[model samples]
Target: MTSLNVTTTTLYMARTISLCFLVALMEGLDLQASGIAAQGMAAAFQLDKLHMGWVFSAGIFGLLPGAFLGGLLADRIGRKRVLMASVALFGLFSLVTAMAWDFNSLMIARCLTGVGLGAALPNLIALTSEVAGLRLRGTAVSLMYCGVPLGAALAASIGIAELAGGGWQVVFYVGGVVPLLIVPLLGLYLPESAQFRNARESAPTGVVRGLFREGAALPTLMIWVSYFFTLMVVYILINWLPSLLVGQGFSGRQASWVMLALQFGAAFGTLSLGWVMDRLPAWALSALIYVGILGSLIALGLASRWESMLAAGFVAGFFATGGQCVLYVLAPHFYRPTIRATGVGSAVAIGRLGAMSGPLVAGKMLALGTGTTGVMMASAPGIVIAALAMFYLSVRRNGAQID
Candidate 1:
């Protein structure tokens, strides 16, 4: 590339990544806001563990269709258009969430909010990866995706502030308003993916089929499995960890701090590991992370002190949450530009099933008398499964040097 070309491309990539950061930041904040507010929500609605699980599941349930259909629509329409719409959808529903007066109302609002979020993520990953180009792609995409953990961390900061007088509605209100403000700016500044614009073929149906085609089959299947398992453990922590900590005798502020620690670790891990992923054997890198994941889960279960649990939560976030971020980083390479969003979307759509089911499963197990330690120990297998799936994909199919 010529010097001028390099300069222009550099500017373009930075601009795109900046927008992705904002969008991802908003998404991270909104998604975790409910969790940060979970205790208050349960109290306000007189909800038990089972009921809270349902509320979490309800929002995740909406994510399923949003991911699948949003990807398809983004392919048919345009990434910029679809992404702008996705933000609008979620922002509107978040305001509705803040307005919710009862359990059912909250559930419905959250579900709709999830739909917008689910659609936005795959596109953000796909677009960021494509725009970053081949060199530094993994690291760039991973860095952009850091908005999620940072956003979650921001929510935890709010919890630490203890500002709402134990009320949770203000979080949603802020979440909703920020996006609404950004919508116009996104239109003005966020360009569509150059790759998507160049290759906007009308092949939405074929794209789904492309995932199952000969060369793509095993990698696609393995990626889906990895995403499902990785996301399962992630959502479980996001939905239940605070409440579980409370049940274990920690104050709400303490639980929030622990959650913040986790997100801080995840944010650090996502950025740090991306550089490693760019240079290391993909499987070896994943295995290294999963070992930490597995070890942390064990530590978390065994720890008796709050400080120890906090430390374990950070380690778990480093591997588990950061591991999931890598999956997003790796996904676009598995398909052509036309179907990249679809492929990522399908993975997330299936993974949403795992995310939705996690809380419900935990709730059922807890209701049936499973202790928090037992519940966490059981979750360890999910990280194991995710590692195995990633190993299979990385070594068997994805190549030592991921494209």
Candidate 2:
């Protein structure tokens, strides 16, 4: 390519990543909003642990279909249009959450909000990957994704400020309004995926057959396993960690601070590990992530001091959320451009099942008096299973190039 063409390509990639990062930021805030607002929501509604779990799972349930449909539609219409619509859908529902009058209403609003959040993600990933091309895909995806953790940190700050004044609704209000404002920006500035446009001429394939055909069956199954288990652990931490810390006698303020630390770690991890993913061997990266997850979980279970808990939270966030990013980066590599979003959306939807289950299971376990240690231990086996599956996928990728 000529110098001018190269410059144009670089500019386009930067613009795409920046816009997508904004969307990811909003999605992160909404995802963490329920968790940060959990204490206040519970108090307001007189909800117990199990009911709170249901509330968390209800939002996650919406993600399942949102991801599926978002990807399917993005493949059919376009990533840009689907993404803008998803953002609007979530923003509207977030406002509803702030005004919720009853437990049932709260669940309905959150579920709808989740559908928007869920739909936005696959489009974000697909856009970033296609723009960056193969060489810089990991770094580009990571840069966009790190916004998620930073947005979560922003939510923690909001939670801390609101907790002092007893205005939990403020977080939802901010989450709602900002994304709506961003919608116009997306419509005006975001470019349609050139790759998607090019691939549109090819004959479409059946979604199910595309995912499982041409030696894709094994990778698809493995991707689902990895996504499911990894997300299960990540969601448990996202939703339940604050309550767990408070239950262990920390002040709510302290718990919020810990959550902030975790999100910062997540941002750092997402950026650093994404860069490392391109440079390091895949199996090594997989091993590093899982071992870090295990050690952090142990630390979280055992730590009692405020500082120790904070450090544990940071480590856990680093590996758990970072590992999830790794899975997202790997997913786009497994399918053709024509069906890429569909494949990614399907894996993400499966992961949402685990995400939905995590909080509910943790809530049940805690309600049964199993406590934090028991919950952490229960997650260990799943982490191991996820690690093995990821390792297998990495080895397979090394053996035969797909695409």
Candidate 3:
């Protein structure tokens, strides 16, 4: 009887984890839908590179408040409730994005959708950890989180299929509609965070303040810098790689196929990096990953041939996306259980600032007539900064709570 009970509990935990993956997948699909559609959106709106950059930044900017407020709300309410709400928010706005008739409306809808997507993440991480026992917690969370890139890969596949002739609207329609449908399933089957419910809520405030407590300043700052730089690289790739490819003379369809390679490489990186981090010192391995990433970016600058383009993109995705994943995997190691969600959430929220800057900066560079080579060259420093920070993190790991 006890054995059967244990088996049933394990099965239930697995189901919870699977649901988290779906939610993460929803975020990936919705977030990248705009990027995939950027060229079409620009054409539809009759906008230039600079204007389109704002559109990109708008959604990412929305992510900041979305993550901050979302994490707080999730703590006050329940992770399941907040998760469902965020999913609904993004889904509804995504539909609104599809129907947008002008640039302003499109920007508004995407930003609002960003809110929902941003809010969903911390809860997903928190819930994933809440259900997982300590021994398997890191592995389980990383596995579920890989759904984000997989969703991005699937979004690229939509373009590859030329569904609706690769129309931008089709991307949002599918992105919005699918999550709406998933909401019912989550509401019905997903459970709230049991730990959150049982614990005495920490005054429902002072969330960020906790990170600045004694002995927690430098590591907190270092991790935040790492998250910022890494995400800057990650999201610049996410939002502009497709459009940049188009600028480099590839067709939209072809660009998306390459972007698909990038996202899939990211998925591979996330999984592989997690495995590697378990076996080696994370900071040292991360430095190596950034080295590979820089090389890939430089090579990507020179990728004029189709084969070279694909190969460079894959390597860039492998290292950049993979390195970002390494950051995510290493983030939670800096906090105790009580503030695990808080520390990770704050870092991710700060990273969204970097994500916001990426597209806009790329737009400015392109507006100044920077070619693919120059653009790729310009972005390499983001990873270099990230590598330096992570290396420092390894040497001066004093800012974390020493529980």
Can you write out model 1's per-residue Cα lDDT over 49-168, one digit (the tens) per residue?
Answer: 899889988889988999988887877787888888899999999999878999889999999999999999888887788888777778778879899999889888887775447468
Which scores greater on lDDT, model 2 or model 3?
2
TM-score each candidate: 0.96, 0.98, 0.93
Winner by lDDT between candidate 3 and candidate 1: 1
Considering TM-score, where higher is better, how would the candidates rank from best to worst?
Answer: 2, 1, 3
| Best candidate (score: TM-score) | 2
Candidate ordering by lDDT (highest first): 2, 1, 3
Q: Tell me the spans in candidate 3 whose CA falls farther than 4 Å from its real position.
A: 1-5, 163-166, 201-205, 392-403
List the lowest-lDDT window of 10 residues for candidate 3: 394-403
**TM accuracy, model 3:** 0.93
Flag clash pairs in model 1: none
Deviation from native of the Cα of residue 34 in model 2, angstroms: 0.7
* Better model by TM-score: candidate 2 vs candidate 3: 2
Candidate 3 lDDT over 320-364, as tens digits, reads 877776676666656654565677677788989989988888889
Alpha carbon deviation, residue 84, candidate 2 (Å): 0.3
Span of 10 residues, lowest total lDDT, candidate 1: 394-403
Worst 10 residues of 2 by lDDT: 394-403
